[model samples]
Target: MTSEFAVELRDVVKRFVTPEGNEIAAVDHVTMQIKNGEFFSMLGSSGCGKTTSLRMIAGFEWTTEGEVYIEGNPMGHTPPFQRKVNTVFQSYALFQHMTVFQNIAFGLEMEGAKEDEIKQRVGRALEMVQLTGMERRKPKQLSGGQQQRVAVARALVKTPDVLLLDEPLGALDLKLRKEMQLELKALQQQLGITFIYVTHDQEEALTMSDRIAVMSNGRVQQIGTPVEIYERPSNKFVADFIGESNFLDGQIKSLSKDEAQVFIPALNTELRGIPISQGLVKGEDVVVSIRPEKIRITEKNAKNDNFFKAKVTNTVYIGADTHVYTESQGVKIKVLEQNHISRLDTSSFYTVGQEVGLVLMPENTLVLKKV
Candidate 1:
């Protein structure tokens, strides 16, 4: 029977020995399930094991311990070509000498497919990537984006049950990369095939992934949709890694089922927030986290709960949003305000040293367990 999951890693661990004779686990007992036809991403910085995990799934690297399963069958020492998966690498790995059609048809030709079948599959793959007419072009003759499409086309020509991408768009320019992100997402949805993407760019993962597994120190820190990962990070690492977070050291003064009152030592006040981490107890040290955009800055002194008087330390206008840095009770905070009103003068902008009222909404405030 076909499994609901396209891939599964059960307590998988990949260990490596450094030149210094020290053993390290590149993937440390990490477990994840990529649903069938899901656009799943493994996201992290360098040396965080995201790439190593992908290599294991692609059969390029075997797990040092545990098992990697594809469609519920254990893939123990399985060769890359024998697996029902295809990998598109960052370098595109295209044949510089071969034409696009021949490059894409390389795999089918190796499989001993009839000449007619090879042509048909290659044509369909190129058409899928919107590069039908460019089949005569060589990899060196195409633009970066076009070359990337050719790589994708080559991978798609095999019609693998699952597609593995390791930073496939990392070689493109910023503008082109952003454009391809949307295109890749759309293609995945249209094809309805499982896409397992590995990337270090947080924004890229957020832009294209249906679900993301945030990895750190060879472990999966959190797995959730972009909304859940950004809005409610599971821990301090996830909160800080996924996006910008202003953290304050605090101790839990009171706890409820969903809410908690944390006493910030820096501010000398209690702030109410949702406890995102489990197993919280009273008097436990916690980190209070809030996104810059979630903070509200008011020019008027609004006397309300969780309101604090702050002085603007710096202001940066970055086109769509203005980042205002403030200091309150020795704690620095950043607030992101959108430029909703068009203005030609500096009068509308907040100047450094200007006093402002900062409000922290309980719903947006997150209390995370200090690691």
Candidate 2:
């Protein structure tokens, strides 16, 4: 572990003995480094070891194998408060009887800090979260978003080297959660402190993280920026989990440096220039994943190598875009297109059972491993 990393998990594993006397690894062989002052996230669904990993880092759960290092120092027996880290949980666990100021200053008071210093630190932390002048109110007087801010301020007043957040925004509604994503990202950058966030929501992870570590089954599938994860997934799990993708089974006919020709059985034709995954070979069975938004649905046929004509089965006109569903060769294809044209005219939008052309360009197509 290097000093540049704020936290390092070297093959950390957490195992629990099930009631059936079976041992299961909740966090298995996970190894990664969180860069200093970076907003990193562990994203996965429930029981995928995301929260267990955070607990290990926060000293709630001890590592069963490997080591956890903070700032190049091993955290073998160090306790939570002594390890220079604080955690903001999903519940926003505040004292109901205490005022906002008291909750925020409680940690400092626990450390035996002078009253004057605790007041100054708590005031600054409140200012950082933009919740100043509401010090006298109790947790019951605040909204969900305000209570979340109080939780953040309470942890931040400690000035820990790293802040561990376990789905802090999971309690908020959709709109407020989205708003806090941007706000938290901005605050992290302004403070230049490491933040380790955990979330199961894909959109929230993409919205806030500087880089994401996508985990599943207690293992990391891939780690990259939001664009890389969405654009080029490493395997089937990643492709299916990140976003909506139309997967078509195929076999590689030929492969080149940047593209591959795949033979899709449903279409009974070969698609050329489909981007291939690393180490893909010819004649190997693969899956061609193309996002619905990438396909263009129009009346005119594009006489290119990667075009298909199908009959539209359904059309749904949402506010910003329309989801057009078409079927051809026993394969249902979904196309998402922007409603840049007028929708008042029902004739303009493709009606059900109407013939439409779908263009799957090479730039937007991704050929993935079967896995």
Candidate 3:
């Protein structure tokens, strides 16, 4: 019988022995369920177990504990070729000496498929990636993007149930990488296949993934949609990693069903915020997180709840937005404001040492556990 999940890792762990003969858990008890036809991403920096988890799913490495299930079946000792999945790596892994057609057809040829069937499948796969006419060219003749597409086509020609991509766009320039991110998302949607992507770039994961698993220190920190992960991080690590957040060390002064009052010692005020982390209690130490863009700054002297008097310390303009650095009661905070209005004069911008009011809305403020 078919399952709703395309892949599942049940408390998976992968341990490696260091050259000094010390054992370390590269993947520490990671558990996740990837739905069929979903674009799931494992995002983290290097040595965070994101790549090791992907390799485990791809059969390059086996779990030291727990099990890996693919399509409701346990994949114990299943070889890469036997599993109904394919992977495209950062290097593209295209054969240098072969034409695009030959490289794409190599997998099918190994499966001992008839020549006509191989050609038909290869043509369809190439068309899927918009590389139909480039089959006769060598890998060297194609541009970086084109070669990447050829690599994708080779993987797609096999028609696996799931596709694994390990930083496939890492080699491309920024502009091309941005372009390919959209293309890959569109292709995944069009094909309606499960895609398990691994990348360290936060923006890339946010742009392309339907859901993301944020990993760090051999453990999965949080898994949710891009908006959820960015807007409501589970802990300090997630808040600081996924995006820029101004964190205030605080203690819970009072608690309600959905909101909490946090007393920040640095600011000497109690700020109200929605408590997102589980098991929060009254008088518990917590961290108040607010995104740089969420804090509103105005020149008007508005005294209200959660409002602070801040002085501008620095200002930076980067075409689309201006980053304003400020200090309130000795606490450093950064604010990002968009250039919504076109202006030629610098008079409207905040000046250094200018006093301003910062409004931190309770809805936009997040209270996380102090991990």
Candidate 4:
């Protein structure tokens, strides 16, 4: 096992047999690597095999094919306890009878560390997770956040080379979940340990991971940095999954080096966009993706070349922001605006049934072949 990479999976495949004897592939021919001390994530919707992949790496499930390596050593048949990895589960599975201190110290004690050494390690791990004074409290006595911290502290106290977290914050409320996300990121940096995090929340994955692998239907869709995944999605699935986008199906009207023009017949307009693929020709079917917030809403008939007129169908006020939904050329477009800014001088406040124009910025509009 090398120390450079904390985890590696090569063409890992896992299958299970149903009650009727049918084979169901939970993980289908996947290969990935998580570097040492990096925050990595596997993100996808429900039943996408994200959690199944994580379990294979954590030694909770045996792979039907391929190999899993930890620190350059094959974990082909290694038992969960033998591998130098720890896991923090979504349930915050702390022992009921053990106090926070004992729970954190349990792993070290099982490893047969000296009394003094276990005390020092457990104390430091507790302090690192900011649960220093609550050592005497049992799991039932601690708040949800505090109990979750105990789970983290228990895993970290052992000083494993890799940590696997399967939606550790899934049980927490929104505010607490957000708080733990920041805390977990900071803690990973402080300890310099590889963290393999799994979550279905796109925003959480974007906010936390250094690099993310987006998976669907037991296969990886795309693996890239957050910006790359969100700004230049490889396919329609990823483009629609990462964030709110306006998807327009049109035919390629023209193509340049990196840009193209798409014609939407319903709108009777040609829209300019960024093309990420080659082999596209004139009249070929294409899909254009543009973020909702990247569009500028105008009250007057703007002279912009890419502007399209629409009627405001509804308005949604979300405390700090407002979402304006409009129908233009048979397509629904959404515009999000922060409520902090004062009334703008140009565009008037949108109202239901009012006519408005939506403009898509050139750089923000992405054009790709339909998936």
Candidate 5:
């Protein structure tokens, strides 16, 4: 996560002619830098051009405008095989007839490495991915997770300068996917290699990436570490896209460097928020976003700021935590609390039709200009 960028895109854009003969913009003038040895990820919904942007980096797709660079070298016109990178696709794309060893060895073989060198490299890679003894088995004989590991082994066997993974865990089941996410993070740290991962799963992105670029409408909306992105989203799109949020449409009543007061006309309350950027003025439409976990439900109104009262509408318990839905000033709000030893006061447990007070943690609330 240093200042030295491993990959840089300068106003890169990609477009394709749809069947209706209209040109569609997929990657729209995106400019970003992936730091050296950083686990950078591009995350977005389907059709947002995250995959298209990765393809351009992989040399599978060409950019209609701008330039793409890897380690300060221009990558335009370079073939995928000739680039200093390797890719692990969602399907693994392993040769069905090839044994694990063979699949891992293929890359080095194609690179013209000597026989002994290929054997040693492939064996070491198999062990690195924890698939040493499974090398003799074919892809079809292994479990989905095992085959996925083999695919990782094949990619690492090449020892490319950078690894591009396009939804590599998309096909795995939930439990397997979660396990692989941790494995991938550990492997990345152990190898100290640059990984450009592409995915739409916000949880996966937040879990594994050193930094994430949230994309929408083929444009990068925000780029930051998980904490920064979650707590200080740049705009409404990013605030809504990353996690569960309770948005209150309001008008900017006052502004300052650290905080602002938003007037919620419907609630007739001045909601305090931490402003993300400047230029907001009085009378300008704005929106304040507060995460569900930031809201606290209480039986009595405590002496504190950022407080409101709501009526309990629903309560959902998901083992370790509880989600309480309530309405305040005709605006719905959600609060999430862990069922831990300290916070459990079940005597005051909220029930439908019961009134409860809520306090939005001002430090956790984000202020965004209306879109």
Candidate 6:
């Protein structure tokens, strides 16, 4: 009912009966507001209901409960074609027999637009997707990325209020996928249209979305900006899912508004000044989430309160960064240290079983509820 949001889902639910005759909620009680001209994403792994939620918005599947709204109007069981939305699927579903121009113009043709209007719209669509000169080529003649562009152009030629993308970059290889992620973000900003993107890849979501809704078991776990989601995760699942984290089981020893202390039995030490999640009480079990890049590997004791002496169990020297695996008090931890110098001798590299000290900065260490 709110005009501020381009798309809104209010407590939407989608259930399906399995082959064993058991009903399950594929999308459970989902509610979100996608702003106009915003790039919002639903991110999760397989079976997390991200694609299911997108389908509900695209009208491929009806919600079992709650409501779906679009552009200040309630969309109750409206057919996909009737709604002001278009979808780009993972398969790049372009008509193989149709040339790029025809593929882009098909939607306008179906809407009964005049020949001149259709040609003008199709030309603009191709230009928007950066396939201006590929008009005469068929889908089969295009590369994977180019074919994907055709799919996007087809959807855009409809001039829908919102575009739903269901893993549109899933079929591309790593390099092309990364390139398209940035390209799509730029395109969304240029067009200023609501984009409801669904993907299981965490990196892609973080790189593209203005805000991300992380889901699991058909329920949304957290929704926030990429920085907020990564740095101040709402729970343990979020910390572990968005990026690499070194989780240490601990219990809260003291709590305060500005600081807290957690006792880790494995390290035989308590970490203090670590930021605590909301409602975290004293004496409650928690996990300390430290990113691999946040931990500093030092040869000396650093004389810091958060420093711990450990032995390196493994060392992997990748060109950009070196992954140092160490064990402190039977707790395995990983440190991602950036390579700043060129050392030709292997002696300069950290060796296995080398004694080292690991430092956990107070700000980077997060105390999260053990979910």
Q: How accurate is candidate 2 locally (lDDT)?
A: 0.91
Q: Give the lowest summed-lDDT range of ten residues in model 6.
A: 297-306
Give the best candidate by lDDT.
Answer: 3
Whole-model lDDT values for every prediction: 0.92, 0.91, 0.92, 0.87, 0.87, 0.91
What TM-score does structure 3 among the candidates reach?
Answer: 0.97
Question: How good is model 6 by TM-score?
Answer: 0.96
Candidate 4 local lDDT, residue 367: 75
TM-score of each: 0.97, 0.96, 0.97, 0.93, 0.94, 0.96
Query: Number of clashing pairs, model 4?
Result: 2
Which regions of candidate 4 deviate over 4 angstroms? 1-4, 278-281, 343-348
Worst 10 residues of 5 by lDDT: 341-350
The C-alpha stretches of model 6 lying farther than 4 A from their native spots are none
How do the candidates rank by TM-score, highest first? 3, 1, 6, 2, 5, 4
RMSD (Cα, Å) for all candidates, in order, is 1.3, 1.7, 1.3, 2.3, 2.2, 1.6
Better of 3 and 4 by TM-score: 3
Candidate 6 residue-wise lDDT, 1-371, digit = tens? 24899999999999999999999999999999999989999999999999999999989999999999999788888999899899999898889889999988889999999999998999888888899899999899899999999999899889889999999999999999999999999999988989999998998999999999999989999999999999888888989899989999999999889789899988898798887667888899988999999998886556777888999999899899889999988889999988887757788788898898888999999988887
Residue 69 in model 3: lDDT: 92
Per-residue C-alpha lDDT of model 1 across residues 1-371, encoded as one tens digit per residue: 29989999999999999999999998999999999999999999999999999999899999999999999999999999899999998899999989999999998998899999999999999988899899888899999999999999999889888999999999999999999999999999998999999999999999999999999999999999999999999998999998899998999999888778888888887786555467889999988999999999985578777778899999999999999999998899999999998756889988889999998888999988888
User: What are the per-residue Cα lDDT tens digits for candidate 4 across 60-87?
Assistant: 8989999999999989878898888999
**Clash tally, candidates in order:** 0, 0, 0, 2, 0, 0
Per-residue lDDT tens digits for candidate 2, residues 1-371, read 24999999999999999999999999999999999999999999999899999999999889999899999999997888678899998999999999999999999998999999999999999999999999999999999999999999999999889999999999999998988999999999998989999999999999889889999999988989899999988887888899888999999999889789999998987888877668899899999999999987655566766888899899898989999889988999888988888898888788788887788888888888887
- List candidate 5 segments past 4 Å from native: 1-3, 273-276, 299-303, 341-348
